[model samples]
Target: MRLTGPAGLATRAVLAAAISGMVLAGSFAIVAVMAVAGGMILSAYGSDLLGFVRITPPQMFWPIVWLLCALGATGLFVRAIVRIIRTERAAFLERTTPLSETTMAETSYIDSSAERLARQVGIATPTVRIDSTATPLAYTTYRPDTSIINADRDETPVIVLSTGLIETLSQSELSAVLAHEIGHIANDDLRLISVLLMPLIAAETLTEDEGRTSNVFELCGHHLSFIALIGVGIFSRGRELAADRAAAVMTGEPAALAGALETLDESATPKPTADLRDHARSTNAINVLPTLGPANSGTGPRSTHPSLETRLEQLRSLARG
Candidate 1:
């Protein structure tokens, strides 16, 4: 689950290459814009404008300005996403009830299973919370960036479950779900996906405020972000498959996980346009069950998780073997 072997190396390479690709794409996009803009200016004003003095040591001022602008936009892009992450997480937390207030009497197995599975994998037992809302939902969260001086992130990742999920699933099925989430914790899927999400969020921001773009630098950032989003899509789906596989292995009950998935699939009838909980839509990537009907199996780079069919097929294979 932690990404080892040739598969691990390949995943690391993909991640590194994706980030590098964004940087290169941004640089090239900016350069191309500069080239086009220069050509237009030269054509319009003729050689007379060239007399304004090109090619002085300090005359590289425009280039430096462009570089600084690009850097500034990058900082802004990152900052915007950081705010978004914090806000969505806050919204999610606000809507969910803590475990202390919930029916803990019914969930003793939840703690035991989480502790045992996490310990088996040498990870700290994740903190589990309950959402009172009845819409079936489940996800894991890791706050590695929560606090630099006193972060207990690796030691205390979180798993959130809705009362709907608890009431809907049997104990064994819930254990399978817990095992699956622990797989995500062990694999560090949340943080890794968060990295991949950066460019997409930047691109999304640009789309929302497209008219605000007054320069080429911002345009370059948009282009590179869309480019990086493709890689993110590919990796996102792969992580789901990895987590599922890890869950099956860890629990030694591919069928139980499979049954849980089937139950969730049945209840997921017609994805809601607006979930009862705020920001629930945004939390899909980390959720145990996705919102849409997409059966994407990492075959399409645009998908975030494997479809139910794809996942069930794998679990069925494991069961057969």
Candidate 2:
């Protein structure tokens, strides 16, 4: 079946859920085994406690301990991973200080155009920032309002455009890109993506140290990371398509988006000798355009974004309509 409509989305959602469940179950199994093993060690040593402090409970309490431990570990993992990502983003912005909001604010033309487009998209004019990188890139992020202490307010979305993108794309193409990002914000995709990343983040923590897997529990946890990545990829691809459709409708310029994608595809084509593997991977993971260069040819299956050809074809269909 050609799964690309509501049915396809449902199927992908189901697959993501199944994969997530498998990963969680595997993780719980590991925790249970470790809890049991620790209990056995304590019992063998005739110790009525754990770590020589907390009193060890009966066999029935081991399961409760495992659940609590797993929950605690998962919570910490999510917090740590989110913090790390935030730290890295902050560091990048700091290092590229010349491209900050104050710097871009001086560019009245871009600011005006973005404001106009933001109105057309039916959302607040997002704070616009520029990145000094030569590689063409654009993305959006949402930071919830922190002013009211605990107000149930919407997030303040920010749209970031790279220097290369500003210099390369035509005005219409640029507008199309911004529209796509606005679509992401309007759909509350950032929150959805953050929630989806929890399982993957936990899996990533478990697999961080390759040599740390000393037992079956660790091994299973490590393997579950790959499964979580698969689920992540599935949902990400669908989200990208949804964003594309939103952009096309909002901009009434599907062809412009296609043109922008074509240009980015050319820029992303890796040089034979350039070590852009990591950059390409990151770009494909988050950027609006998939860097379909020579360095990433074999990523057809694992890529977070759909193929350039696929995206272009979809846009072309939109254009025809």
Candidate 3:
């Protein structure tokens, strides 16, 4: 799918929060452990130097308190990392499901269309897959196949379009949508986005493991790793908008892309109030919209794409020229 501005921003924000949470947990652990260690050292040696190496009540009480707090923070961090993994896994599963029963016939039609378009555009044909969800969406995926790899040939990219999206748009509009995704491939935007976000993913995984460790030193390290993840979230939204623009240019039919946006807007289902509230809390963002916005308007901190109205406006503007 075209990474709309809001979607990119949301992704970056999630990465950032993961990083921040990890860093905070790590810092708390380190400080707590150091305090505990210092207390123990003083209790062990202070009496010897002063000829009264006796364990005092206050000294013993404070070390235990510090250790307890450190353990609690570590638990909290572990929980947060587990939460991130579950959410990420769900999203990945949704994207990678094999196009089997969802829309076999519709997928075949689109795959045919994509091959035609590929030939027309003078690019190698891409294998197309369909996702059955009614939510209008499309995206391109590329992987280097070792079996097919040759020193003289470039690895091929794969394209996927949702059957719901194909049914929603006209033939011309579908072509425009395909072109937009193709633009991503042409610009190597997918690889770029993946590479840019890899650090955040790694940090997230690290925090997940380290946060679980009981050692105060390891727990402290988990919190320190999240700063980079937060940085990833802040910038992701802008990149999505850029990709949309790239798609429009590649298709040379801004109105078709605009129409596609309108179709997605209509297809979106309403989210329940409880779900919206839950999302807000989980994401730690204020004024987040319940639905994905169109290309141009209604963007918020948590939105993954721009509003439909805004996207349509840009498309119409381009079409007029």
Cα lDDT, model 3, residue 101: 47
In TM-score terms, candidate 2 sits at 0.73
Model 2: per-residue Cα lDDT over 1-321, one tens digit each: 111234576677678767777776666666656655665564556544464786665776655654665566656554665664454345334423323344443467667766776676566777777767676768764442222122123556567677767888888888888877777766656555545555565554455466588766457656775677677678777778878888888778899989988887787556323323324233344568654453332254455677667788999998888
Off by over 4 Å in 2: 1-7, 46-106, 143-153, 205-222, 271-283, 291-301
Q: How well does candidate 3 score on lDDT at residue 293? A: 31
Provide C-alpha RMSD values for all models, in order. 5.7, 5.7, 10.0
Relative to the true structure, candidate 3 reaches a TM of: 0.52
Per-residue lDDT for 139-195 in model 1, tens only? 876443463223345457678898878888988889899988888778776666656
Pairs that clash in candidate 1: none
Best by TM-score: 1
- How do the residues 165-228 of candidate 3 rate in per-residue lDDT, one tens digit apiece? 7787887777777776665555445544443343344344444463485654444445444454
- CA lDDT, every prediction? 0.67, 0.63, 0.51
Candidate 3 wrongly placed segments (more than 4 Å): 1-109, 119-123, 142-153, 199-236, 271-298, 301-303
Clashes of 2: 0
